[model samples]
Structures are given as C-alpha cells and as structure tokens.
Target: NNRPHPEYSLKYNKSRENRLIAESSYNHVITFFEGLMNHREIAIPIKHIDFSIGRICVLEVNRDITQSDIHILKTLAKMMYPLMISDKKFLNLETSRFDYVLSDLMNNPKPNMLLMRKKLSNFKFDLDSNMYLLCLCDLDNINSKSKVNYVKQMVQGIFEKHYVFVFDKNIIVLYNNKNSFDYFKKCKEYEEFLEFIKNYTLSVGVSKLFDGISGIRNAYFESLSAINFANRLNCIYSKEPSINFYDDYVLHDLVYDFVAKKKLHYILDSTIINLLADNNTNLISTVKCYLDCGENLNFISDKLGIHYNTLKYRINKLKTKYFIDLKNPDSLVKLKLAIIALEISKGYDLDLGLN
Candidate 1:
C-alpha cells in the first residue's frame, strides 16, 4: 500500500497542472463528530472530506465494531466515492440546465422557441400540470449578498413547489399552483410571504396565474406591472409595503390593456385628469367615496373620519366646482372611473384631493 501506484507516472499539461493547484488550494479538512441530529442518532458525520463536494454520514447501529466489519465498511466507502462524484456532477448539471434554456428564451426568443420549451419541459417540469405565477422581489434594501442568499433559501423552503432564481440582482420566482387551490386560496399564502419581505426590508410583485408556456412572457410583464403598482401603493398609503399582486389591481391592468389594445392612451378625458391631479381640495376624494360607497354618505363619512355635515359639504362643493352632477348616475360613474384611473396612474403624487 505504501508503494507508488502505476498512474502516478502520467504526464501533466498546463491545464492539468492548473487543476492540481486548484485542487490543492481548497481545504478539504475532514471533521468527525458523533451526535444525533434530531432523532436519527448519527453514528458518524464525516464533514466535507471531498473539498466541499461531499459529506459522509453513517448512522449508528446496535453492534460492536470489529476488524472485518471495518474492512467491509472501508470497501463500501471506496466503492461510493465514484458514485458520489458522479451524483454531484449530475446535480450541478441539473441545477444549471434551466439557466441555459431560460437565458436562450429571454435573449433570443425567435429561433427554436418550441425546442427550448421542450427542453425545459423535459427537465422535471410539466407545463400542463403546473400553473405559473411570476414573482419579482425588490432587494434594494437588502444589505448584503449573504442576506440575499439567505432570503432565497428561506423563500425556496417556504415555497416548495416554486422554482426560485436570481437574475440581474432580482429574485424571480416561477411558482407552481396547488391544484386544489384557486387564486384567492393560493394568495392566502402571500400573507406569510409578504410578511417575510416586510421584515427583511424587501418588497415583491406577484403576477396573475398563467396556464401554459406561451403565457410566460405575459406573466413576466404582469410581475413587472405589479412591482410598479406595489411601489406606487407603498408611497400612497402609510401602511408598510410588502407585496402587490397583479390580480389585486385588475382595474389598473384592465385600463392598461384597453389602452394597449386600442393604441389609445388618451381615452380618459384630459380635463377629468387635470381635475383629479389638481389636489386643490378634498372634493375628488369625497366623490370617489360617495361612488365607492354606493352613495352611502354615512358609510363614506365614517370611513373618511369626517363629520356627516362636513362630508355633505365636500360632496356638494365637489359637484359645484367640478361641474360633476353626482345626482346623475351616469355622471357619478364617470367621475368614479376617473378617480380610479388617477389613483392607479399617479398614486398620491397627483393627490386628487385624497390626501
């Protein structure tokens, strides 16, 4: 056993020498410990014996150690090394396979789109069985890369059915829906998701459900839109911002979609917008509340924390100054739509008297 093996005489090129040097640099310091991780009763935990590439775990048994038993164990250990190395290599390849296909789809989507999709589908992902929602997290407030990685691990553990990735410093999620849960049911989980983001100074945007591979681009756009909406919502309300779902802002997305389809961004009246943007007084808010509350002045008053008489005065003044006849159902609807559009478009920056 002390003699040199026959393979030691092999010639080395620059690349081989470099590989040897790199291998030598990594501290493979093997650690031995005996303990029970929970209830399993680990007999031996040989930590990082293969340069951070492998760990050996052999659980304790009832029998006493013998020379023959040790020899058999050593033989088994030698046999496992090759399999362990191969498994590690396969896992690395598996982990990075998605990255290559996704990069191709994002960067050059024209050629082999179907082929790339097929390639993606072959990799343990079933398009038909999986419902997808895209998520984008804003990590501007996250202090360090270690924190980002920790967040990633936490999210992955939390969202087990999700495929989480980091692209261009943003965490992107391709979430798989549970077949039993509907949109709102699945969304209940976000309470925890958003809470995590809030505690970690993170904000996230979640896309609406998309059924198939073709909808991936749409889902991404939805996530992007939700992020913008979330940021706007964060600034508008004093409440802490954590997540904004695109589905929650259905009206805003609808408006944008309508404009996109019609190639007309100016469908809403400029005068109405100007009035909403003025923020001169509380008239716009009063009108919005009146319409929103179905003309229930008392409800609106209670919500706004204003006196009934004060709300009435504001409503009457809104009708007078804006030339909006809240008395007419059609006019009230128009005013309400305008106010919503303004809220979606400008948040509180334009004010529309809501402040």
Candidate 2:
C-alpha cells in the first residue's frame, strides 16, 4: 500500500496477533506508481490530486512541489471529471443492453418460438438437457438500485449455471435440479440460497423441475404466483418472509383466492356460505376435519371432542336445511369448493385449523 503518510498502514489481525509499522521512509526520489482511483484519490510523486473524470497528464519533477504544482493538479482534476462520468454512463448503458435483450425475449413472445429458442441457445442456456427450476425473489424492502443489482449478481454466482435476470423488477434465477440423495437434501440447498441473502427482507417462489423451453413461460408465472401468494398466506398466519413452492400448492391455479374471481363465489350458494361464514363457525371447521379425517365419523368426533351423533346431526343439517348432501360424493366435492371460496372471501376463523 502506497501511503503519503506511513502511519496509515492497512492492518488486519486474526486471533491475538497484530502489528502497526510506522517507519517506512520510502518517499519519492524516483517512484513509479499506480493508484487509488476507484476510491476517488489520485497518487502522485509530490501532491495527491483528487482528479475529476477526464484523463490527466502530469509533468513530473524530482523535487518537492510548490504552489504552482498544486494548482496544475487541481486544474487537471477539474478537467477530468466530465469525461470520466460520461464513460461510466456509457459503460452502464452497454451492460444494460444485454439485460434488455434477455428481458424482451423472455417477456414478449414472438411469432416464432423456435427463434427465441435459438437466441437462448446462443446464450449458452441448454434448457433442453437440464432439469430446470425457476426462482423469482421478491424484493419487498430493498430499495436501492445498486443493491438490487448486487443481490441478483450474488444469486447468479451462487447458482453459476443458472440464468439470472431482473425482469419486472424481480430477481429471476433459473438453475438445474441438483443430484440429491433425497427430498431433504434438495430442500437444504434451497434453504442455503435463501438464507445467504437473509439480510434483505425478501421472499422467493420456487418452481418444480421442468426440462427445456416449453414450460419456461409457465415456470416464470408459477414463481411470481409463489412469491405473491405464499408470502400473503404466511402473513395471514403472522409468519415472516414466506417462501412458496409451486408443488406444495396442489391445484395451484385454484388455491390463490385472488384468482378465484366471482365464479367460485357463486358456486357456494349464498345461503350455505352464510350458514358457515361466522368468524367462529364450528360447522365449517367440522367439514374440513371430516374431510381430513378420511370421512371417519369416529375419528373426527374424537378429534373435535364432539359426541358422534351430535357431529352426525350437524352434518345432516346441510341435507335437511339446504338440500345439500354431505354423504353424496359429487355434492361433497362441490361443498368443498364452496367452503374454500367462502373461507377466502372472509379470511376468517384462523382457529378453525382448516389448514
């Protein structure tokens, strides 16, 4: 380290050992140097010039510099600033061009899907051969643009084989399904990646493995849905940083309440839902328990601490009061759908233990 003052020695220590050397008397009689430009300092023989962006040419002298030397250095630094800033902007633009190219190809589909495949092929993405998983990390709290870039690059490096991109302002990472001994092993890897950047309050949605470009669009959509709905479901239960797996949500298209629309709501007749919609409805809970207990009256009765006949009576009330039959399989399926829609609409009865 070249320091104008020797006392400014760069120091680091591990354990209980350290040294501070303050006696390096090597001053510039004839010293060739390269410097601290990135930190915005310019090292010179006599006076250190904090120059601006333009290129500077300094005429060297053997002796200590006078006031004239200081003036010339300041003048050169002032001239350099504009050119350096311009060069930086140009470099950023060039880096961003590649990002834009990948973005357009992934987001906007063209007439020829094969051409898009060709484009990705040229970029060294062998989607056809590898079992790929797509992950979209939602940046809920990180607001700095440079930090966002850094996080994206960090994840990309961690999964070096993956295609990492910032599409729609989310970090999208695509990587291969690794060689794992079991499901637990696979989950550990996923946990490692998420935990590494835990400093940033973000949630990630992961897609199940799929080969090739055919399902790429759907995988991206799946990841987006995961980050959005998973975190929401977690928040509903007072959990932080929800990570949703596409596979965990069976019939994922129907699981998200926001996507259900007015159609599913109408499926659950207004009368039946009203009967079950109270914030502390035992009837609704009994229904989910009944299903979970494999329709065994004894099992649910014991679990709910309800007398078997009493549970039977409440269940039969559907058929007698609303002409809805729980015993009938078709009717049961319809009721389940209706109840799901009802539960979503109200977001009520967390104590019901439906999940």
| Cα error of candidate 1 at position 25, Å | 29
Kindly provide the TM-score of model 2 when superposed on the true structure, using C-alpha atoms. Answer: 0.59
Against the true structure, what is each candidate's TM-score? 0.59, 0.59
lDDT of 1 by residue, 130-230 (tens): 55555646444322233345556667776776677655445667777755225534676757776666655566666777776566666776777887766
Scored by lDDT, the top model is 1
lDDT of 1 at 17: 30
Question: Which residue pairs clash in candidate 2?
Answer: 52-80, 52-81, 53-80, 53-81, 54-80, 54-81
lDDT of 1: 0.55
What do the candidate models score in CA lDDT, each in turn? 0.55, 0.53
The local lDDT score (0 to 100) that residue 183 gets in candidate 1 is: 58
For candidate 2, lDDT tens digit of each residue in 1-355?
2434332221111101111110011121222224422122222221112211122333344555566765666566556545555655522322354466556656775425677677666667665754544554634432323334556766776677556777665777666655421343465455766565354556777666766666666777777766665654554566666456777554434733432444434445554554554433677777778767777889899999999998898888766766666677876776666555554544422332222
**For candidate 2, which ten residues in a row score worst on lDDT?**
14-23
